[model samples]
Target: MYFLSKELYFPPVDEASFEGVLAIGGDLSIDRLLLAYRNGIFPWFDEDDPILWWSPPERMVVVPSIYKVSKSMRNLLNQNKFSVTFNQNFREVILGCQQIERPGQNGTWLSDDFVASYTKLHEMGIAKSVEVWQNDELVGGLYGIDLGHIFCGESMFSKVPNASKIAFVTLIKYLKEHNYKLLDCQVHNDHLEKLGAIEISRETFMKVLKSEEINFSSSIQQHGR
Candidate 1:
């Protein structure tokens, strides 16, 4: 595996290991983070390990036009039991993601430094959150890096049944309406697969990531407008 230094550089994704670990030991500076995401790379490591960058051979992505919502989810949306908002409370959304326990994970990868760094990204308007509120309480939410046309989702948490799903569906609808190219879930999971996310070769994903057709102006419309 390659090791990163002070230089804001990363090895090509094609050079990654079989497990997709591209490089290790890079600071999550704003510039580095931005550069990483723009190139279809992301950092994921446990709290005790050095920052590890990855560019998987296959990317799990949801094309906005093709995202699927189940009949049950459609009924839930029709009921309007939850309200969704964007960028209203990013810190809390990320904190929720950090604290929520997952089935196979021993602990979260979202350490304090990771939280603070991504929070700074949110302040700078590059990171965004989708909050699901029920009776005005923060029941569920998700957060990710928004790179104009592609949304690189990091994590999500749900305090109640289906809350995170609601947040996700709402975000997909918004993206579809606004013409987003892809929702980069980054990796495959059964949950995402159920919601129409599919695996594509890194080459296919990189094409969309590096596409010049993206309308940067589309990113300016924020807060669920």
Candidate 2:
């Protein structure tokens, strides 16, 4: 594996392993994280392990009309029981994502360093979050890096059934309304597949990410803040 230094760089995307690991180590500075996202790479590692960057051969992504919504979700949306907000309580959202248990995982990948780094990004307006609230309490939410044209989803959690789904549906609607191009899901999973996230070649994804300028200001505006 290619190891990184403080130089804020990465190996060529093609150099990534079959498993999609591109590099082994790097500090999660704002510069490095920004560069990594621009180049279609992202960090994923456990608390005790070194930072591992990845740019898989196949990427999971969704956009405006591409996501699938079940009839049950449509009914829930019509009910409007859950309220959605953006960039509100970002720290809490990330913490919730980390604490929510995954079926096959023993622990969270959102370590202290990762949380701290992403929090900084949120402060700098480079990251964004969507929260789901029911009866005036935070129930579920999702967070991601907002690259303007594409939103690179990191993690999400739901305390109630389909709370995360509600957050996701709301996000997709807002993105569609604002003409956002992609929602970078990172990897393929049954959950995402059911939501209509599909696999595309990494090369194709890179082209989409680099093709247009990211409208960060517009994304912020989409929140009506």
- Candidate 1 Cα lDDT to native: 0.88
Measured with C-alpha atoms, the lDDT of residue 96 in candidate 2 is: 96
**Model 1 alpha-carbon miss at residue 139, Å:** 0.6
lDDT of 2 by residue, 1-225 (tens): 798877877889999999999999888888999999999999988878998999998888775644557798899999988999999899999999988888989898888878899999999998899999999999999999998888999989999998999988889888888878888899989998887677777876787788844343343245332
Model 1 reaches what TM-score against the true structure?
Answer: 0.92
Every candidate's CA RMSD: 6.3, 6.6
Per-residue lDDT of candidate 1, residues 35-143 (tens digit): 8998889999999999999999878877787666889999999999999999999999999999998888898999998999999999999999999999999999999
Candidate 1 Cα misplacement greater than 4 A, ranges: 212-225
Which number leads on lDDT?
1
Q: Kindly report which residue pairs in candidate 2 clash with one another.
A: none
